[model samples]
Target: MDDVRLSLREWLILKDIESALRRGRRIGGLLRTPRRSIWLPTAVGLLVAASGFLMVAGIRTSDPAVIWAFAAVWPFALLQAFRLLCRWTTPHGISVKASR
Candidate 1:
């Protein structure tokens, strides 16, 4: 390349672009975090709540089928709840390995 030089205005613009690219990686990582998406957690919470309702109905009416249904669903619901809890409770800095 022939001698290349950036005028003051072009240099400032390039500096801004570099800064933006530096920040983009952090933004990308945050977008990947589970907390940003509400649907999955909402669904899990609904499942756990529905399981509680089923157990209550089973006890109140002495229904074996309702109790069995609750049993069948409870494990998966609770596990999802636990995993979601762990993920949400973790500090974003630690989870994303962010410096700032």
Candidate 2:
């Protein structure tokens, strides 16, 4: 790296590119962060399944309260699913511990 000389303008541009990459990585990490937790995903999965059951019951009986209950649970389930999807879409990589 020392063998290569960059002009002041080029150095600034390189620094900008590096910062942009760092910011992008941080955002990606935040988006995929739910996978790092155990209970969150488990709860989301349970909620999704329960919501499905609720919807079926509401449909079979044509009950207003049960339909409303389904409406309430469905949004949360969808949000959690979206969060979970982020982790699934993230590419796996070789992770290493940082040196002390």
Question: How close is every model to the real structure, measured as TM-score?
Answer: 0.57, 0.54
Q: What TM-score would candidate 1 get against the native? A: 0.57
Q: Which stretches of model 1 miss by more than 4 angstroms?
A: 1-35, 93-100
> Please, what is the whole-model Cα lDDT of each candidate in the order they appear?
0.81, 0.79
What tens-digit string does per-residue lDDT give for candidate 1 at 46-93?
Answer: 998999999899999988999899999999898889878887787775
List per-candidate RMSD values in Å: 9.1, 11.4
Poorest lDDT segment (10 consecutive residues) of candidate 1: 27-36
Index of the highest-lDDT prediction: 1
Q: Tens digit of lDDT per residue, candidate 2, span 35-55?
A: 366776898889999999999
Query: Per model, how many backbone clashes are there?
Result: 0, 0
Could you tell me how far off, in angstroms, the CA of residue 2 lies in candidate 2 after the best superposition?
21
